[model samples]
Target: MNKSLITNLVAALLLVAGVLLNNTLLSLVGLFALSGGLTNWLAIHMLFEKVPGLVGSGVIPAQFEAFKNAIKTLMMEQFFTQANIDRFVSGQDSQVHLHLQPVIEKVDLSPSFDKLVDVIMNSSFGSMLSMFGGASALTPLKEPFVLNMKQSLIELTQQESFIELLKNQIDQPNVMAEIRAKSKKLLMPG
Candidate 1:
């Protein structure tokens, strides 16, 4: 049922018929087909296993360390370079947009509002806010405050310093070492 099995079967039949009929050409063709199929099978097997007396076998597992290093080098050199990161961050296609809507939506600003009320109560405006029911008077400003904070964060990310800071962090020796360690663990997990 396997392709190799079928090929071997046909080759065997050809060889048998050639020998019984004394046909040298058929015999040669069958031998070629059999050898070709066997060679292909052996090559495929050698890729993942070491065959005795075969050179360059078991390549994948044997050179796994080298492969890991190569991958790390490739990523750091080609993908994570400062210029490449800056290009991607500042690209006109807008492929990278910093969205903080979900974060802003989940934030509880009540504690902050209460703190603000405390500061205001201790200040000269304490008497004025007392008539307005203290911190509850600021409840109406929560939405606008959150929206302004989110907008400010988005604007900050567009600044050159933000991109430089990101690049600097990624380029740090410790961060790069940590990345390599994680990648090695992933490739050769015990």
Candidate 2:
């Protein structure tokens, strides 16, 4: 039925015919054919089936778990690492836009305005402001200043040049590594 069985049968017939007809050539050919065919068949069999007194046969079925683990180790160590993933993401052709408007809008700019007022008061302008009702004169401008600052930040962040700059910085090797490290730390905190 199978090639190995058919080969063995043909070889045995040749051997018998050689012996009957007293032909050395046929005998040697038959011997070589039988040996080679049997040897190859045994080797193929050993890969998937066990045999008595054989040291390393049936390796696939017997050590399937180890084989699976080896494949997993190879993929994780060589292909699926953080650096590899970063390279894949950074190698994309499309633009990377960072939407920071929400964060910018949510930021409290009152402290920044207060700092500006303090700086003005500490400078030679302090005496000039005292005559205009001290820092209260700037009080009416606080809400407008905060709103304007937030709007300016949102506009700056939404600019194409700013987005491109951010993309370049993020794509840098050191910055990517730091981001990966921080993300890993957050995901797998100890």
Candidate 3:
């Protein structure tokens, strides 16, 4: 269940029980509990945004409802700002290549040659003739194969889907709620 929905459900049950008991003290306690849940609900709202002109001044109604806006701005400044991006771009990170190299440092083609030969033999006769032929076949094809492999690698490296995947993950609501719940638990009593 969503945190807000869980809180609302609990608050409603507490309020109903307090009313049924017909006791003033229990009703007062229920009101406090309801307020606590309402605070959590409101807090979740203000986390991503802020209420306008909610000041941090002396004798003000809510001296720090603006805390949420300040926190949001600080978060953006630290992690989502252009300056941070520029800092990353200017830092030593450009040299930090994290892509994994192929497990086999060199693919030894010698072991696979028999399969290639068999495949060639199974194909048309002209291809088989070309496969068993002299240096003429090997010499011309080697450079093209190397160039094609390098081009394929370069294209793969330039793809941006990995970055997009991380971007999407960071914005998922369930992910955010789990993080929020865990972080809240660290400081709050049950």
Best by TM-score: 2
Return the TM-score for candidate 2, rounded to 2 decimals: 0.52
lDDT of each: 0.74, 0.82, 0.56
TM-score of 1: 0.48
Q: Output the better candidate (2/3) by lDDT.
A: 2
lDDT of 2 by residue, 1-190 (tens): 8878998999988888888889999988888888898899999899889998898999989998788778766765686577675665564535534579899988999999999999988999999999999888889989999999999999998887887787777778787777766655554456
Candidate 3 lDDT over residue span 13-54, tens digit each: 777788898866777776888888888766655554556664
- TM-scores for the candidates: 0.48, 0.52, 0.30
Q: Which pairs clash in model 2? A: none
Better candidate by TM-score, 1 or 2: 2
Q: Supply every candidate's count of residue pairs whose N, Cα or C atoms clash at under 3 angstroms.
A: 0, 0, 0
Tens digits of per-residue lDDT for model 1, 82-179: 55555554553356645544665577765665677688888989888889887678778877776676667667766878766776666676766666
* Model 1 Cα RMSD, 1 decimal: 7.3
Q: Which regions of candidate 3 deviate over 4 angstroms? A: 23-29, 56-190
Model 1 stretches astray by more than 4 angstroms: 1-45, 127-190
